[model samples]
Target: MTVVLALEKVTKSFGPVEVLHGVDLALHTGEVHALIGENGAGKSTIMKILGGYLAPTTGRVLLDGAPVTYHSGPEGEAQGVVVIHQEFNLAADLTVAGNIFLGREITRGLGLDHAAMRAATAELLARLDTSIRPEALIRDLSVPDRQMVEIAKALSRKARVLIMDEPSAALTHREVEALYAQVDRLRAEGVALMFCSHRLDEVSRLADRITVLRDGSVVQRSLRGEMTEDGMAAAMVGRELTDIFPPKDTTTGETLLEVRGLNVQNLVKDVSLTLHKGEVLGIAGLVGSGRTELAEGIVGLRPATGEIRIGGRQVQIRSPRDARAAGLAYLTEDRKEAGLLLDKNLPVNLTLSALDMWGFRIDPKREKAEMTRARKEFDIRAASDEMRTGALSGGNQQKLLLAKTMLTGPEIVIIDEPTRGIDIGTKQQIYHFVRALARQGKAVIVISSELPEVIGLSDRVLVMRMGRIAGEVEGAAITEENIVRLAMGLDREEEPA
Candidate 1:
């Protein structure tokens, strides 16, 4: 393998906070070097330095053993370097081919080379074995296809140094496999890749070498033969995850909520289920399979036609406010988008949902007391309850979301991707919390894309596929293979007698 790029003594700081401290890495041709760490562990910072988006305070970046400084955008682009962030830079109004050649359009004298750009994009998509039509508008494309378009755009730039951040974050398992195949192909073609991801298993499967960063410094650099998924995770967080999902006691109580003929577009179609008090009902599915949608619809976040009974009393929930008034709290999947008030203080978020329902409260002392207790109960680590929720880490943010909902004292709680973007230790904490809610006689519904989490947490698993209940498996009967098979509509077994 040929050494394509190198980072030496790369130190970076913003104001008084240093993000990277003498981080070193080397990427050889045909290499898939994975950089992984906690959310704020400087993975993105290092990538930005390499891609010329940000300059390091002190460092030497080398290409072919020769020191090369990256100062401006054109400099990195000219040297076969491109960085693809999780937030795709595609224009939704533009056509797919148009997005691929956005600023650097092929021109014919005074006009654009529309025919050539389309052809090139088509060729790139074909090479990646993607089914995205180059002529299709970006708005019409699915999330995975949009990602493919992003990859196509990077490839069109003649990129040899490709940095993909959380590339499979929104991808289904099958889409992830497709992406892995393309990454492998790109590697074989001598493209040096540094992929940053939270998915440790994916890094272990695809990366030729693994670099784990902890607190902005290199903790471990394991070669192909040395890295295991568990080892990578251990090195990344500097601790062993004894119980990713702590064991749960599954003795369920009385039925606290019941649903009948639940129908919602793109999410649920005639979905019927019952969530018992002191029991967890998990909705499991692949990405885009209506797991999150069902949760949102039931919580009145979307247009829905359904029968929901809380504690055997029928209630109509038209909106989120109505849902909360009816004793239902929903924790949305994307915390930044739906689950949090980033600008608000932690105490405010925790008490906001319950203030109207519980009684109009202007008592700062009581609110602070409640927030302090819940924070400790949920292990929400931050500077203070007065601190902005946005300033907290992913795990702390998730815990805060949970704390906010628990403060509502709802009879039914719906959590979508409860542990997403959180660490394993935090995940276990969340698992314990959900189980405790059931034990406290709250009807709990957990919607998760992760099969293990759903199976592990559920008293009964309801598998959703294409806006319908695919299958319902008893909690004890849940296995990854069965859950996936049922989720994909492969099983034709009768619903629990």
Candidate 2:
């Protein structure tokens, strides 16, 4: 194998804090190198350096073993290096083919070649086994489709060295399989691939070589079969993580929330559920199964016709404000887009939901004091409390969001995709947090696409299929096989007596 790109003794610093510490990494042709780490472990920093998005403060970038400087990402791309960021970088207003060939379009007699670009995009999408049309606008695509588009755009670059960050984070199980197939094809084509993911199972399956990063330093590097998933996790967190989920709550209390005959237009139909105090109810399903839509409808984020009861009393929830007033809170799955003000500081974001508690005048001191409390309570780690919310790591941002939601002091909580893109260590923290809420006699609803998460966290699981509750599982029956069967509509028989 040839060393296509290498980072030699690299150190990166952002003002007073140095993130990378004399790191050394290399990518070889026809191989997949998996980078595994906790959030804030500097995985993103390393990827940025290798992809020429950021220059290393101390060492050199070696292209074919020769020192080279890339002033910008395009400079690196010009040399056959491309990076697909975890965040979608597509233009929402542009068509798929247009975005794929945005800067480098085929020209014919002083005009853009739309037909040729669309044909090429169609070929790329077909290669990825996707149904996305070349003429479709990016804004109309789902999260998984958007991810595939990003991958297609990178593939269009004809990159020799390709870097991907959390490529499967937004994809469903089937879409993930499609992505893996493409990855295998790329590897067979002799493209050097490096990707970071929170999903350890992916690393176990696809990686030819694995690198474990902890606290901005390389902790372990091994060939295939040298490290187990558990070993990689231990290396990343520097602890033996025996279990990630808290023990399920064995007790239940009075009914806190009930939704009967709920309908969210065409998206969610006739969904009904009940939440009891001191219990966690898990909603599990595939993407487009209407799990999120149901939650959004219940919380008044979407228009819905339903009979909602709080504390055995009927209530009308026309908006999120009404839901909040009725002692209900919702944590949106798309936290970056819908939940928080990315450019705002901590105090502002923290106190935005519960501003009524402070009356007409906003008190800066009280807000900062509450933020300080939340940092301690939720274990939110950041360089400074005054920093923009977007600058924090995914785990820390999630914790901050949890804290913000809790500030509303709701008796009923609905958390959607609680650990969507966070690291393992933070996931454990969140699981414990949910269990603690249950212990405090609060009713909680957890909606997730990860079956293991639902089985481990919920006292009872409701499987959603095409906008309705397909079936329910509880106790010893909440297994992946059972939930998947329900989500896929493979089983219609009643539960065993």
Residue-level lDDT tens digits of model 2 in 1-497: 99999999999999989999999999999999999899999999999899899999999999999999999999999999999998789999999999999999998899998999999999999988889999999988888899999999999999999999999898898889988998998999999999999999999989999999999999999999999999998999999998788887458988999999999978888988889999999999999999988988988989999799999999999889899999999999888878899999888889998887567468888888899999999999988988999989999999999999999899999999999889999999999999999998889999987887898899999999999899999999999999999999999876899
Which regions of candidate 2 are displaced past 4 Å?
493-497
lDDT against the true structure, per candidate, is 0.82, 0.92
Best by lDDT: 2
Per-residue lDDT tens digits for candidate 1, residues 1-497, read 98888889999987777889998899888999999887668887888888888888898888889998878756888899888876667898999999999889999999999999999989998876777888999988766678778877887887888888778766767777778888888898999999988777888788889888898999888888697778877787788867776566766777778889988874578888888877888888877777777887788888889898888899898898999888899997778756788899987888877788657765788888988798789887775678788877788888888888877778889998888656555677789888888777787889887787888888889888888888888845888888889888888766896
Give, for candidate 1, the lowest lDDT window spanning 10 residues.
420-429
The reply for model 1, stretches above 4 Å from the true place, is 72-75, 92-95, 108-146, 340-377, 380-393, 493-497
C-alpha TM-scores of all predictions: 0.87, 0.97
